[model samples]
Target: MRTVESRNWYEKSFGEDYLLVYKHRNQHEADRFVQRVIEWLELPSGSRILDLCCGAGRHALGLANAGYRVTGVDLSSVLLQKAKEADSSGCVRWVEADMRALPQDGTLTNSFDAVVNLFTSFGYFETDREQLDVLKQIWMALKPGGRFVLDVLNAGYVQDHLVPFSQRKENGVVISESRVIQNGFVIKEIKVEEGGSRPRFYTERVKLYSPQDMENMLKETGFLLDVMSGSYDGEAYDERRSPRMIMLGHRNL
Candidate 1:
């Protein structure tokens, strides 16, 4: 008999391959996004910020460079290592923790002045209740009236514009991806081939939640939805057209 390992796709897919797959998400873009978030939050210079699901610490490092106290938490130790390498200044604190459990020894409760979860990091859980639990944890980690920014794929726009197949080559690696929508989730199958190495396969799936769904979740989780934008540039959200759904909310006092 063979032992079977049971884990979500996210647990296996976010290892070393993920770094190469997403290497194009550079610091310049993160800096720009952090600037927009700072402007939107209007918090003090030394405010403590939590970059939840802060893969590779791009945005967290950017925030630290901009003079905010930043703590970045991600589930991938491999990515966290990369983040630590990039953060030579030792400015941002990086922690390996799942978003569903960010208690951090009770120190994280009501700790952050602002929390930012960018790049469509939400909606990975298997159940709606679990997704809501993540939001509740975010709310608990924030101080009264503290702000949060969530950036996710616009469900309507993605439904309308999803590309079924795409291929690209980067740094001697050929990567191919196929996507499909099923049962309220966007599922992507990825294949990577480098030189004579055996091909690697990975799958990524995220629940496709509409803006209204997110709004209601925030409200139910004790956050006041303040603004919804279509992009990092702060354009208003359009259900049929927006490429990204960026939302700003505050912990209800």
Candidate 2:
């Protein structure tokens, strides 16, 4: 069940301040990740791609630059505007919508060759059923032979390498973060402060799901589990030490 307080945390957390807090994330790194995805998936040059929860639209833009048809979707209007401004040529299609319900009822159904949910976009909801519903939506949004890439944190590694507190200075702002794993969810409370402006706090929560848990969800969603990679370099998944759990699933042809 979702709590009233937690219900809208995401809406509050992803705002103008978010751009400042995460300013270090750049297009170069995103382009590298996009290149890896292209080689790993062996996707055609003009394949259609849906970048779900695409904050700032870097990866989506990279795919579009590579001659792929891309649609980037995110709930934050603030980030969407940044994405639109970055697209000077206006190549990629940007849509502001929640991941749970990607807009356009029948228009987007079976409309994509591949869907990429990157950087721990999964596990925002408080319930398992709600999270599974997202997978169902992705499954329905793909063509019969389409592929799906779910990039998420490795729960085992997170638990093993849990950092309690951290601090960093970026762009004249001091950022402090306190992290804790409670009730099977990894929660981070971030505080950003400038010299004069008041400190702004944002909370991010991602539920920890095991590899078996992800497998079960994909199987239930009707996606044929294909590969599970631990790193963007295409190494095999090692639950205990891997930094990421990137699963590749296929829709039955």
Candidate 3:
């Protein structure tokens, strides 16, 4: 008898389909966001930055273009290939690695001046310990007085604004999504259908953690929470109204 293999949705969902689905996340917007990040970091130009889970190197390349040395790490080989193709200037270094085991070696320990994990990249792990482990790795990778910026969906806003079902057409493909909150996780079931082709199905599961939870976790991992913004524009965070929770933390000097 054959046993079914158990794999995480993240391992399979972030291939070519993901790129196509999220193609509209353009470089211009990424650059704009990076500008905000640069101002928030308040670090000198040319400081070393790591873009963890840097899918397609959008933000990574943006940071590189803005005069910072950037290393982009992601688990998706396909996305990394796209990032390489787009990185004509060779400004950003791309690495294929999991967030849970970042750098995967001692060569990069305490190397980066700032690390940015954007677009809700955290909370993929099944357990709280595993989720916290990712933060620990980020802490270990930063030098003393280094900074970190994490962008994630606001759990309160998500709970209030979640639509059960939505459908749209993009580039001749019909994309349908069904979302439900289960066991403190927002689970999305995506279906994509192209004309005269079999429909493809994908799942995305992200654990929901409140802003306070994030602050506590970062503090416990040796980061001093500095700023918590509601959006990319540097507005103050509001648990009841913020669309995104953008946290800035600093390692103790």
The best candidate in terms of TM-score: 1
**Sorted on lDDT, highest at the top, how do the candidates line up?**
1, 3, 2
Residue pairs of candidate 1 with colliding backbone atoms? none
The TM-scores of all predictions, comma-separated, are 0.96, 0.95, 0.96
lDDT tens readout by residue for model 2, 1-253: 2224554678888888887777877888889888888877788889898899999888999999999999899999989999999999999989888788777667568999999999789999999998998898898789998999999999999999999999999888899999999999999999888999777778899999999999998988898889999987878999998999999889877
Assess each prediction's global lDDT (C-alpha) against the native.
0.91, 0.89, 0.89
Pairs that collide in candidate 3 are none
Taking the tens digit of each residue's C-alpha lDDT, what string does model 1 give over 1-253? 2234377889989989998888788889889988999998899899999999998998999999989999999999989999999999899989899999885697788999999999989988889998998898899899999999999989999999999999999899999999999999999989999999888888899999988899989989999999899988888899989999999989999
Q: Give candidate 1's error at residue 142 in angstroms.
A: 0.2
Cand. 3 Cα-lDDT: 0.89
Model 3 bad stretches (over 4 Å):
1-5
TM-score of 2: 0.95
